[model samples]
Target: MWSFRTVLTTALVGLQVAALLAVLALTYFASQNVLLAYAEKLTERVARDTTTFTENFLNPADDAAALSQRLAESAVLGTADRAALERYFYEVLRSRADFAGIFYGAADGSFTFVSRDTSVPGAAYRIKTIETAPVRVVELRYVDPEFRPVSRRNDDADPYDPRTRPWYVKAKASPEVVWTEPYIFFSSQRPGITVAKAVRADERLGMRGAVGIDIEINALSAFLSGLEVGERGSAAIVAQSGDVIAHPRPSLVSAGGDQPTQRFAKLTEVDDPALAEAVASLPGGLASLQPGETRLTRFTAGGESWRGAVRRLAASRTPWVVVTTLPESDILGPIHRVRNIALAVLVAVAAATAGIGVLLARAVTKPIKALATQAGRISEGDFDDVPLPPMRIRELDDTRQAMRRATSWLRERRRENLALTGQLREAGRVLERRVEERTRELAAANRELEIANRNSNMLAHELDHRVKNLFAITSSLVALAARTATTPADVATAARGRINALARAHASTKDATDGTLAAIVRSVLEPYAGLEGFRLSMEGEPVTIRGANVTPVGLILYELATNAAKYGALRASGGTLEVAWRRIGDGCAVELIWSELPNEPVGEGMIAEPASAGFGSMVIEAMATRLDATLQRQLTPHGLRVVLTMRGLEEGGPLHGSAQAGGPAAGHSRGDAARRRAWTA
Candidate 1:
């Protein structure tokens, strides 16, 4: 007799395993069918395309052969005292639109040619002056009358003696015309195939030799390039000897970089262990030959398995083959994808099953456990507290009723237990009374500590406020002193400027804000705004700083601006003020520059340090220190420039009211007012 939980779990596990096996079986069969279909389709496509392409491109050889025969009979060759033959050949090559070039091989091992230079049109016929034994191309040129280049033959060229050429040899072997393997032309060293025919001169006509047309292999490359296979698929032309002839990847023919070779090599490296071995053993052009049948082969290369097929070319005389490959993973990819999806769903189902199992187990076990607990409690004289579930099985209901009766009988005994418990609780309360009083004392101490902390915070904030206010007042007092001094004419103006400096500093110290240091400087210079000879431009990031810091930086910029307004380039016509700032690492700095215009003759500066520091100078120094900044000032011919660096604020805190406002400093007294007015002026 299995328990309900065990029976349910076993059934669930069995069902899940069965479902997994079923899915796997379906996937396996489906995958096999899909791969078989894919291979068949691929092979059919290869066979059909190869046959169609060959039929379209390859013309009947009889026409070409007869054309060759006619050339041998033409006066051009019959008279062929080299010069006349050269001229005749040149005319023929030029007249024939499809003729890339014409090559005539002699029994003496010398080849002659007259052809249009496709790379250079309208060029004179390139004649080969062959004097070498056999293989060396002597003189190849494209030149006209005076032997001057229509196209001068390249001096260093390989000779292509017609007798040695395979196409010529193959043509002479048979009266029918035929195509030859890709070979370098002796005259140009260019890769191409030659269509040649043996000279079967009639006795009635003076026919000299065989004539061949060397068609550039690139023409076939163009032909093959037009075939568009499916994604990640490609086709190439390979010689019967397995040499890559023409491919979409032209670089494969070159020596250095081997992208095509690497691609093919990768195709050979598929991982379905069986597929990998099959491809390795398979040869090219096997599948496409049969048209309807597919030769499915898989092989391993680079440690992975690949699926591929090969078929023979129908019209190709060179025994060419077309080989195509795809990763086995690609052919059966749908099945794998399906399997993965099924597995994912199975995982979810498994998880859900386990969750349900836990819930079911708990549901069934809880009632039995509750009954046992109640029975134990009843044994311990807790009859009045017997617990009953909301619903129960019929057997459990009977059990509960029996327990209830037992409890009733034990009720008198429970009264005895309750009286004893009451006495024990009274003893406990007496013991806890002293401990509670001690705890209360500790709680009171905590309250006092909390109050002290709050007070300290308030005091600190108040101190910061006052100190900031005091510094501002002092700055205002300095401004007032300067304004009251009307002694030296130059001194008085300077004094007035000092007062303006104070006002500038005060203006920047608004309520509080964030990332507004640049704004503060601009606000300070606002009084000098719209001044004709001076132009003020501000750039760089805006940063927020403590109120204490903003004041000094603002003042420094004001002093610099005032000087520029009075004596620097800003004084000259077309003068401009450019102020820019940026953050450098942990700190930020601003450069205030005044460039003098070419409009006016500027006066020379004192060029010496001041004998005594003015209020403005002192304030700038103090502010720089408080803000932890570096101050630099230079009076160039253009204008006066001042740069100030200041510490920036951290991420979050109380909103800096004045910083963002770019407003005037608030909470100022009357003395501060007079100073601000004079300085702002």
Candidate 2:
């Protein structure tokens, strides 16, 4: 019943329009749901982030108060030390910018406070002290960053007393730390809250005191104002008691006048219509919200739809609420715009398609059969370029020419593909060779790294062993010194001298493969060589001592030198000391002789027993026993002379019997016996 051209035009146009309409419908609905979800998620993320930030800002005040309480309880800080307390509070305020002030109030109505001084031009901190005992007066000192006083004022008429403040009262009553409700600071007149804790009377000065730190809320408001909410969106912090703690507009949260009783502004007085409506729309208001619970609501205010999320701060001792609101248009406006654009495109495209379809149907209906036959021939690879029957229409002729050109282009592309395939194969071979070389290089590098790691591990083990030995020696010295010394000062002096001797010995031998007896003697006695009228002479053949013998030999030398410096040779002046060593017993043993000549004459009876058989004699005897060496002392008219004979002095020789046989317990027993003998003598 229909002509071929008419049927084709009608079918093509109808199918295109139907497909376009279906795609538009699906895209619009899917996008609408996605945009709505995105808006909800964005609002919730803002609310959660704001709540977290608020908690962080207030946590520092709590921490500072706790720290102050501990210091007070431990008696490290007390009210009587007003100067120290003031300095400490000033430092705390300088370090913590968020704190408005730090103060301590005593039960006797005495107070010490430090706060930021913005009233003065060049002042960085202000110290306020109220004395109730000797004088009832307030002293104000404004200081700079270096604590230099810039200005000082005496306020004798000021009636401010910290004991009457709410923070002080609450802290004194509560056993634990407490936070006061948000109110205006007495000095700054800024809306803030205080974190305070009570100091037990028995702990410090036998009197009770409370410490408080004030945190301002204006910074919180500024933080909210700077937050990136959606366009035309706003956020606020509200307390459960119906006070607005923070708002994007900072002025809305603070009362303008000097009414301290009504310092904080209520939510209704903020003059933000959208925020007010959103809070009112919540069921039972923000007070009904539980901690860590989030509630979302929608409302209309000022003839615009608004969406909001209300979340309470979690784990907060203070009940604070975070509210974030956004207009509904911020979410749906973009979706609607995109939908309108799609519709316009659909209309333009549909009109063009229908018109083109009609023309195409009319033009191609006659010449289509001829074109199909030629296409079939081309599909079969018959590219002989045989001339076809001539077409009357120009479009059909041009299509015929284009088909020939396309066949030519296909043949050329086939030739180029073959060439390209060969080149790719060559490139693959080259890449394989390069990969093999790189693998070989990496393998070589891995082997080197493994060798280096083994060397590092070996060095670490050696260092650890040496450090442990040094610690053992130091601990023994400290214990022995503590046991024999009479006073704490004596203990410290004895231990420090012995430790220094050991440190010097270690440093001298740290870089050498083996330590020489002469080097150890010089290192131990170097400190006394610069004394006036003192002379030190050394005569020795360089004898190598085993690593295990270095510390003991060095300590023995130190004790003898210290005795000479204290009582015999180098005590007053004009003293000479001689240290000599020689290899003995087939070059395996060494004998060291220490000879001292003092400026003062010594009697034989006075030298029969050592002047003081104290820690020095004990140390010398114990060390000789530990080394398995013999120590002989002879007192002559010249001075004191000592001979120390040690075996197994060679680096390769077996260590001494005592060093190999004695553990810590054996060594300690010998030391105890030696100390007892010295005490008895």
Candidate 3:
């Protein structure tokens, strides 16, 4: 059997070694995965950047052709004015240096072209005019930067005709803008492509001519040469036919010759063996790539593993793929270095952990053995006090001290046994008094709880009563609306509007004993208060309304507001409504005036009065009866005015003739007739 110290030390060292090994393994694999993902992202980013650059280089030419087509079709820049056309073409060419030429070829073989003369030392513009009206002759005029002609010549030998060019023919055949394949320009003998569009002379006429803009491919090559790929990595732009359009090495984009007839170099024809090999190793080569799709692959190039990504440019008119390749060594180099460092750290920690474990175990066991010897002495009935064994560990030292203290305590307890017996009797008497006092306190608490319970029950009964009242009012409104509405839809609309108004009224008085008259009126009109050209103003002395009267007053306001919105001031432009109130009759009643006026003059008989009372008038009469209020109306030349007198509106006052105060009475009998007359007026 192993000794306790040996077992403890061995367990500690073993656990430490296992944990270190697990951590090392996890780090090694996780780092590899993370680094691999990073490499993939880097490859995709390079390809996307190349695609963006190519699009930027080519988009302008397409835009220019479209703009020029519109201009020509609109007759802004026409062939009738040769000087203006030349100046416009010269400006376009100067503004866009990448454009080799701007030319318009007509159906009758008439040509007007403007091109930059780069063959000379200084800046010069050449305008080639081929007039087919009189005779087929090419006029070449070289002008300075100011557009002043410095030299002019005629070449009858030049056989350039607008009707036979590829740009003209393709544009004429297709109604939309057309792009030609990469080819050598006929005039400049430079490798470029033409973007062209057919122009119609008139809306009813047939095609008259085509406009073409030549974009130099050398600009694209130069842009590609500036991109920074990873170390030992390169990027290239290749067409769908495996022809190299652009490369980091400009010389590789074209065949090694000064001949103007030479075309762009093919992928295999380029000197880059690694790029060619990577492209060949792909699943179906460049032709298999689709627009807006990025594909990543791994292949061996030049005896080295490489990661490559090909992304097709989605926005380009031509089908082109950006190929980016990076060496695998560049990606794995950092991860390998990190793994080596981690291994060294693991070894060092393991050695240190072994040494520390042994020292800890020895330190622990020495104190335990000393504590054990002390315990044995106590078990053998040695109750006398003795000095404790010295220990470095706090727990072991505390045990030795406790043993010494226990031995002394046992000796003293034996000597004081009778004294303890006497004290126990006195403690029992004191505990009994405490129990009696606690009982009395608990009884008082129970009494208070009963009072709180009663209050809660009262509150619940009040809430139940209010909810039932609300449902009763809602049922009455629905029944009344159904009786008067012309259609089922009208019944729903009227009932919903009235109930929403009641809800707003209740919300205004929620958590409050009462609310002011102005607040109640504003709440009912809130929906129409913010409408443009319809002004609403409220002015009052702030007379308070009892809680029971809030809903009644709100309903009356809703009726008046609805009438105004439908046929009164609110229906017209620049309408205004004014609500003013004042305290009346011993400060227990309020008199409110509602006035409406339109901005324009009202002619006599222009405002048509209803033949009979409508639903709104009935609602007003009902709500007035509920409030026990009096209403009177007047129709003046300016507008309609109504006055309302509400009684028993003071707080803590009895509402006269109200059902809540007493039984209902006939206080609103005269007011009902007056309200009807006012509603019809």
Candidate with best TM-score: 2
Candidate 1 per-residue lDDT over residues 1-681, each given as its tens digit: 555666676578669867887978887887777785776577447545754565444453335445645766665445246666566566655555445576667656666776655355555556765654645557767765333466555564564566776767786677667777665444444445667776755655432456677665554556556665444445555554445555555545333232332221122322223323433476543333433333555566456556555665554355655555555555666777887787777778777786677677766866666777787787775677655885458887787788788888789877788899999999999989989999999999999999999889766764564355435544543444444455666455654565465455555543334336556655655644544444655554434555545455555655554454444544444665666655555343433332333245544552112112644465557667876767776655644556665554324422223223233333333222121211121
TM-score, cand. 3: 0.46
The C-alpha TM-scores of every prediction are 0.42, 0.47, 0.46
Per-residue lDDT over 195-300 for candidate 3, one digit per residue giving the tens place of the 0 to 100 score: 9999897757888899999888877677767776667788888888888887888777767487756777898799887678778877987778778789988888
Residue-level lDDT of model 2, residues 1-681, one tens digit each, is 555676777787678878988998898889877876776777788889999999889888878998988787676886678898898898898888889889999888988989888578788888999998677989999988888889999999989888888888888777778898888666777778889998775643443789999888788888999987778888898888878888999778877565645478877787888878878999998778888989888899889888888899985577998889988788888878988898888778778877887787876576766776777787786655766778888987899899889878877777889899999999999999999999999999999999999889766764664565466556756765676689999889888887787677566644444465656666756545444466777655545577777767766776665556446675546778888766667767778888888878876433333445654466567678878999888887788888889887657763332221121122233222111100000
Clashes of each: 41, 0, 0
Residue 474 shift from truth in candidate 1, angstroms: 99
Give the runs in model 1 whose Cα sits over 4 Å from its true position: 1-7, 20-28, 54-66, 74-100, 108-110, 115-125, 129-161, 185-190, 203-208, 222-226, 256-280, 283-296, 301-305, 331-339, 361-681
Candidate 2 lDDT score relative to the true structure: 0.76
| Candidate 3: segments with Cα more than 4 A from true spot | 1-26, 120-123, 184-191, 340-681
User: For model 3, where is the 10-residue window of minimal lDDT?
Assistant: 672-681
Cα TM-score of candidate 1: 0.42
